[model samples]
Target: MTDAFYDSHCRVQAEKMNDLAVSDPKQLVALSEQRYEAQIRNVCSYICNNMERSHIVLLAGPSASGKTTTAHKFRKMLKEEFYVNSYVVSLDDFYIDQCRLPTLPDGSKDLETVYALDIDCIHQCFDQLTNTRRASLPTFDFHTASRSIITNDITLGDHEILIVEGIHALNPLITEGLDASKFFRLFISVKGEYSLNNEVVLTHEDLRFIRRCVRDYYHRDSSLERTTGMWASVRAGEKKYISPYKCYANLTIDSLILYEPCIFHHFLCPLIEQMDPKCDIYPRFERLYHILQYFAEFDRHYVSEDSLLREFID
Candidate 1:
């Protein structure tokens, strides 16, 4: 279940728990990492036990919810421990061309909707993989916002599974008419909120925003303005396309790392200090910066190489 505390009880809980700044950061960091890995191991064990019934794992999450990292790690653990060959199939690669996409009310491309994907192509891929244990997949280029002609062909041997990761992974359209018994679905996100002085201080939404800001700046060449400007739409898309289907998931994973707020705070504080305050999104960052100050910073070097935090920070 998603750990949440509100009111006076929540504040007392956060105050008692948020003591890493005064404690040994190194020891606490190791313990925190272990806790997260423990959850992954348990999930893998469950999936392996049910291998006879399910070969396809659908992983769905909202923006900046660490879906990509969890999907890869889940596949990695399955192979390393159980010797189950699992392949991660990114639904992002199946997106149709941007020009042909359906538009929203403001004339902007509705890229978040499941309709943006080629439904027929997905069915074809599933058929091929289930029957022949091989499928040639299309590659979508984000820079061009179009599907590349180049194909990625993948083959699965006996005892292998395909893990599909995307916002629409849990949508019924993706699995309609298919045998529901053949799939295991997971929904992951940061579901916990931080409280201070009996009031909510930091929320999962704020945490995700900070993550996207840092990720886009470092990897996507996007400015703070660009990411913040689109924050509303990203959230709206999550509620409309992602959250409603969360109930369809067989399991939900709380992707929150207790020490992650500090890691993000350390990097994001310095980075946002350089942005233009006059920008519309500056106020949001200001609010985040305030809430972040209550938490202690964690050293990035101590973060393990396989840490999911590596997906965004490094």
Candidate 2:
């Protein structure tokens, strides 16, 4: 879909969120739950209808687009609806060794590029899984920035599905020789924004940025400063590799939860407060903090532990 389509969709959803926040605050949790369940059911239906012919499912999206959680949820729903087995293979586990990664003009490792991964090995694994229904997959240790010595032996059972998720999963290079009909492609992203007093307070990318910052700090032990520093490179990689292949997806999911910003405020406020005023990203942090002022704080208790929002917060 075009940017205009998503912009309109986000606008309507933002308005709905505002109305719900004012009219029935207690129902926000239920509304969010229903919306999430509907999307899961929609994906499950697509898989059920196509299960006979599709063997591989490629789910790609930008950073912090809820890809991992979506894959897990889709797998759960598929098992419930069809009683079939599925394996989720993370492309992240195939990252090339740090020393061998391509260097950018500024001498920084360009980890976001598809070439940062071992494409030949990935192609072979895909071939093995599809033909022999089994393959040995490498596991990457993000902390050490190297591939682990141990590999996972993944096997697909009869009538099973193989889900490969990563930022570049839909890139043509990953499935070059595979039949297009044997694959189901999905592109998931946050496509909504919140407006206040007729002024746009946040954009779709802003929501994703917030998610990334929180997730990086809490889960990856990355500082906000480091996360902010890497964002430009991340967006550049998305533009070069991910965005161009979006049209190849058979389905697109907007992974935004309307109450996300409110929930994020609790975690981000303290982090933003800790930033030094003179730091390069302090101004950006201040702006984000200001935006949160327009949103009401949401109680974490209202959110289910399994919610996609949990992928980033708590």
lDDT of 2 by residue, 1-314 (tens): 11221244346234546556656656776666667778878977888788777778999999999999999988888888768778888999999999999999989888889999999999898888777888999999988999998899987777788888999999999988866677899999987777765557889899999999999999989999899989999999999999999999999988887778778888898898888999889999999998886777767777877899989977
Predicted structure 1: lDDT: 0.82
Pull out the clashing pairs in model 2: none
Which ranges of candidate 1 are over 4 A from the true structure? Answer: 1-14
Report the Cα lDDT for residue 109, model 1.
Answer: 91
CA lDDT, every model vs. true structure: 0.82, 0.84
Stretches of model 2 off by over 4 angstroms after superposition: 1-19, 22-26
lDDT of 1 at 11: 28
TM-score of each candidate?
A: 0.92, 0.92
